[model samples]
Target: MEAAISTLITEFKKYAGKDGSSSTLSKDEFQSLVSSQLSHFVKNASDPGTIDQLMGSLDENNDGELTFTEFWQLIGKVACQQGCFSQ
Candidate 1:
């Protein structure tokens, strides 16, 4: 679990830094991250509209960017949807 969390943090930082904003993920950064790293999880990764919609949904404060917390929430949602349960 620790290693998985660490990896998630590393990926987030890597993507966020793409746009020179090591604090948040811009639209392009988010798209690149999802398409390149989360292609297996996110559907239609190559669709611009899908990426835009996802980015909009994840932007809680309407800041047009995704924070680490927001990104984690998205992961949780995808996990639940994929039935990655331990029951």
Candidate 2:
């Protein structure tokens, strides 16, 4: 659990830093991260429209960037969809 959490943090920081802000993920950064790391989990990862829609839905504050909290929502959603929390 600890390692998993750490990896998530590390991955987030890795991509988040690509656009100068280490705390938020720009659209391109998010797209790159999704394509490179979440291709299997995110459908249509290669589609720009799909990525835009996903990013819009996840960008709760409408800031055009995804904070760690917003990014975590994606992780939670994916985990739930994958039955990671199923008993």
Best by lDDT: 2
Error of 1 at 2 (Å): 0.7
- Residue pairs whose backbone atoms clash in candidate 1: none
RMSD vs true structure, all candidates: 2.2, 2.0
lDDT of 2 by residue, 19-66 (tens): 778999999999999999999999999899999999999999999999
lDDT of 1 by residue, 1-87 (tens): 999899999999999998767999999999999999889989999799999999888899998889999888888888887897642
In candidate 2, which residue pairs get closer than 3 Å at backbone N, Cα or C atoms, i.e. clash? none
TM-score of 1: 0.91
After TM-score superposition, what is the CA distance of residue 29 in candidate 2 from its true location, in Å? 0.2
Off by over 4 Å in 1: 84-87
Which candidate tops TM-score?
2
Worst 10 residues of 1 by lDDT: 78-87
How well does model 1 score by local distance difference test? 0.90
RMSD in angstroms between candidate 1 and the native structure over all alpha carbons: 2.2
